[model samples]
Target: MNKNGNIGVTSENIFPIIKKFLYSDHEIFLRELVSNAVDATQKLKTLASVGEFKGDLGDLTVHVKFDENTITISDRGIGMTAEEIDKYINQIAFSGAEEFVEKYKNDAAAIIGHFGLGFYSSFMVSKKVEIVTKSYKDAPAVKWSCDGTPTYTLEETEKADRGTDIILYIDDENKDFLNQQKIQELLTKYCRFLPVPIAFGKKQEWKDGKYVDTDEDNIINDTTPAWVRKPSELKDEDYIKFYHELYPMADDPLFWIHLNVDYPFHLTGILYFPRIKSNIDLHRNKIQLYCNQVFVTDSVEGIVPEFLTLLHGVIDSPDIPLNV
Candidate 1:
């Protein structure tokens, strides 16, 4: 029961295994990390609604900051405790982080969170990873630091906020994460309409000779995405408008289905079947998956029924797995 220590697994080739396989696209690591943060935040909202924990629900935003050295993802969510970290991060056998990586190194997307190994994928592009977090409870903030290895160190830290900040020291090979344009593109691709607002940088406007910072933040996501709202509350134009937002270059959608079911399983979303041109593979993964409006995955085949994969639209279901 080691907290923030070597991931208690017998596998020694786990790191190399994950780097070699698991995901089809290296860029997907960003999506998995961000989606996890969104899920954590949404879980807090669900808990608060049930009157589980009475606390001030401050601005729930996911901030993605990148510099020459690192890429950081910070969120004001229900931060994990020491024990929770041990259960989620240190233990991999129960979750399947190692097996999936070993099985599917050639196909990147296959290396996804098949076994709750989403967080470990950071090692693929990062030499070192740090988690500075403070739980919603009265517990002190803690800093968990780890190199690209199984071992880690967790100790107390000075943080006034009750949330988590994950910093990934971009590896020399994966310097693309440091590029502002690349980061922004990934955000728009994977998290255009996340439940929480995601801010990458400051707003810019044309000034005297060049662009200058505005008081506004460059918020990347639509806090209240079209899929999160009720179909009854929205008009046909609204769905069409959001469709354009997702595919500005394409024509209008053919038809759509507003899914909202809260019984055996909780689900809510709007699936649109866009007109196809040539091959169906071109539009295979157009349907984006979201957990409580937080963008999870665009390549959603396992979560949605097989027939729905060819459609083009947004599906924001809190019950769906982000790694699926």
Candidate 2:
């Protein structure tokens, strides 16, 4: 057999390829945007820790807000200037995340982005997208707007904050994302255990007659899941509690194992032996997989033994090379 050196790509348009192939699920746009926001927030924290930025780190929550026709993801992270937008956004696939990670490899703990292609995933569900951002350094804020095409516009804009806001105008085909309940559901599924607190809408309370929005923000994640914590610091009850948090109606697990490994590759997680029923297939997808607390998938067929995958719990490792 004559082995070839490598295959070559012919298509120059990356957006269409991302639209038709990169990710199968259109809902993945939410995970990608939120992960980027977390990365930005994390990068700022790193800068502040190293005395690069002396400003007070305000509330770093990534907020997801939507009106009838648009959804805006706001983060109080290291924002970008016009020049950065030109480098990161306009010059598609030039990864800012990769560069940041390399520079701060020792200082940074966990960063969730690898491919710069994440931003364009917005176009899968959006007719138009806008990025309003201001760098943490003394600089003017700018707005970058683009439709579904390759062309874009970047101009000086007024923004009081020193972070970024990604606004997406919902397309007619993907109008279901504009719904509040739908967004909350997706956030819960993808960002339930992220490192940063994410606010979606507001907590509801039973008022005089019906339910009303409370002053509290509906924070969607637990920054410190039990898996990420030291097992020595936890009790038997803590494991049970976390298991129920993952499976609300299920009974107490028969046994549980707390995993904390850092040899070949860093890994941390907890596995619970749930009360197995005759229908084994039902339990196959119970084990959730993550990369640096960002939910990757519930399917872990390749990562673990076929039988062990039936156990319920979580496994997170930044080193896991996922195809997605």
Candidate 3:
């Protein structure tokens, strides 16, 4: 049996493994983490609809704020309690967080929550991480703070809201997360259609000679995306319109498949077959994967059949693993 409150069985060796072998695309770490936040927020909405919680649903937004020293991802969602954290964060075995990190530490894109290790990927970019969260239940808010080492401290905190605020103390090596442009790019790439609104910064308008902040929050996502809606309610033009929303520069898609299965597993979305222009590899990443409209990966080859990856537009399937 593993020790309680321990980070990982093979914690020390995992970072090196991630840096060397796991993800071919290191920049994708930002996408994965933000998507996970979006998924959590959407799940809360679903729960609320079923009368799980009667609390007021505030602005369901995922805010990405970055400064010189840290990058913070805050979300209004269903947060984990201490016991949930112990089950999800502390234990490590074959399919545990430690083993997953060691196996995919190098591949940043590979460090998704396939083995339920999505939250821990924060360690890859930060020297220290703090999770300030309050569960939807009437429990007191808690702050779970951890450094890169195996030790962590979870204590009660004063959070007025019911959500999570993940603060990543940007490490000396991974300071790129602190860059405003870089963070914005990741948000646009990974979180354009999340069920809840995601805000990266203030809405800017060209004023006088420079960009000036507007009263509007710069929302980065479409809370109610087309994929989440019933196909009967949508027309061919609606699907075409959404396709252009995804690929502005590209030509119209050939045909589309509206996937809305909820029996064996929950899945929904519109997969459009774009016009392939000879170079299949160039168009390989055009198909975007979303868990409840929160973008998870553009590389959807593994989750969808290999043939489906050639298509463009969105595939919003909660059944698919975040890592895939």
Best by lDDT: 2
Tens digit of lDDT per residue, candidate 3, span 69-172?
Answer: 98888888898777666676666544544656556655555455655556666766777888888888777787777776667787787898888888888888
Per-residue CA lDDT of model 1 for 195-249, tens digit only, reads: 6678889999998999988878799888787777877889989999988887787
> Each candidate's lDDT (Cα)?
0.78, 0.80, 0.73
- Decide which is better by lDDT, 2 or 3: 2
Model 2 Cα displacement at 218 (Å)? 1.0
List ranges where model 2 is wrong by over 4 Å: 1-12, 94-115, 281-285, 322-324
TM-score of every prediction relative to native: 0.83, 0.87, 0.81
lDDT of 2 by residue, 1-324 (tens): 111111112233544544554334778789889989999999999999999999999899999999989999999999998778877877654334346445545432122244445777898888889899999989889888877666677778899989999999998988999998899899998898999999998999998999999989999999999998888899999999999998887878999999989999898999988886668545643888888998877767777788877789988898864333
**Model 1 RMSD vs true structure:** 3.7
Any residue pairs clashing in model 2, and if so which?
A: none
Model 3 is weakest, by summed lDDT over 10 consecutive residues, at: 1-10
Superposed by TM-score, candidate 1 places the C-alpha of residue 15 at a distance from the truth, in angstroms, of 1.2
Superposed model 1: Cα runs more than 4 Å off: 1-4, 94-108, 253-255, 261-268, 271-311, 316-324
